[model samples]
Target: MADKKPEPATKNPKKANLLDHHSIKHILDETVSEIVSSRGYVEDVRLSNVRLLLGTVIIVIALFAQFYKKKFPENRDFLISCIVLYIVFNGLLQLIIYTKEKNAILFTYPPAGSFTSTGLEVSSKLPRFSDIYTLTIASADPKSISANPPVELTKSVTKWFTKDGVLVEGIFWKDVEALVDEYSKEPKKRK
Candidate 1:
């Protein structure tokens, strides 16, 4: 008599490949959705920088305090655990800050989107992207109060126009330009 072997028991009745595909697809969809929905507009750069700096300090202090505590077994274990937790949780905090920076878009549309940022505001009732103009980057004039980048976006428009020339204390002009370019994209098929 031939020995009988039992068939493999599987929790999921579906094909193994299909289960793998489904889980991967679901995870990707959820991740993409979260990223897309997490749009942020950083109206204040200085405040964000300060908060980031504080987080950095906390992390640094946590790591530095370990030197004295490492001599004891229990204390060192506690410190190690705390530091690990801090690092793990800090990723979430950093993501929030990153999203804010990504969304720090000083808009240029109707209702005159102003972010309280020191940058050019189209004060006139002019249409956006109507004028095919050039960007003339003048030398940066830094303010003393700012600890971050002193880059500012001064509109290369004439004084006759309602172009508010501002010295953005913390807003980097490169970051602004990237957002502006993204926002200014025309739809493939206009509604």
Candidate 2:
């Protein structure tokens, strides 16, 4: 058999290229917000699935009661009692959930990760893999600064160059070295 020519992969026509012009921070913020919001959406879907399954089972049992009436005379009373109980119980649960909607939260899935240390607590809002990019931190060489002693050793200066080529000096107390290290390894992270 002859090998067929590989088809050109179709790109999404509707996908927006608007984000290309935006900064990394803007993209990171949007990604973080989407990830956080999806938690509630996921829980809503889970609860909806459970509600559907229970409703289906209840309907199936009701049909079974009707069809087996002739063969199961002794079980008729039991089935009827079960039907009443099921209706009442399910109805009560629905009423309670519906009425308490304002007071109670619809979903309560636990947070993925949380940490508290001393008086201040910390949480990581790391960006998705696709957002990874090389961020350059250009610090003035100590030797160069020493030769040109206008700037003291203790008060050293650094320049930050973002992936988007926008250069900003004195982006204070920035962890660019650590961020560069993270950017290299983060995309390859398994979990």
Candidate 3:
């Protein structure tokens, strides 16, 4: 009797690759970050800096008054007033910024330098899924508090179903091209 050998198990299965979902999302995020960065859009660091400065100044003054209470009896009232004023000012600033940035285009998505899932969406299906990324780009003017609104552009890109465990399909250069073109255009500044 001739020896019989078992046939090799098939490597390809009908089930969808779940890893593709994460990979696709990651690639999309990286691409979006790169594009936004290329267009010179970056995180608004000045806002954080201003917040830090205000906090430091207020805390130092309060500490100084507390440490010298005996020498300055009036400082207790001064400290109380300072804290109340700071709270009011900080609250107002937060409200204003929040109100301005509450829109879908501004608050949810991360600036160019950060990574976040706010603008990325993945389909629920397992065997087949689509990855869609949406972003709005705008230049942050650090010089003026109320500088004219820089040009704003919203762009979205989608990758269709992943077939046969192979992640090869549409690159969507046209969508990206449109974004690049608009980004290259000179922003309008108010006189």
* Cα lDDT, all candidates: 0.35, 0.35, 0.42
Residue 69 accuracy (lDDT) in model 2? 54
Q: What is the Cα-based lDDT of residue 94 in candidate 2?
A: 82
Rank ordering of all candidates by lDDT, starting from the highest: 3, 2, 1
Query: Per-residue alpha-carbon lDDT of model 2 for 42-154, expressed as tens digits?
Result: 22345446667767767776777777655666787868877886797578558645653322222323223412111100112213434333222111121432121111111
Q: Write the per-residue lDDT of candidate 3 for residues 15-109, one digit (tens) a residue.
A: 33444665554444444444444434443445446656766766765676567645556566776776787677577567645653432222123
Q: What 10-residue stretch in candidate 1 is worst by lDDT?
A: 132-141
Pairing residues by index, what is the TM-score of model 2? 0.29
lDDT of 2: 0.35
Local error of candidate 2 at 162, Å?
35
Winner on lDDT between 1 and 3 is 3
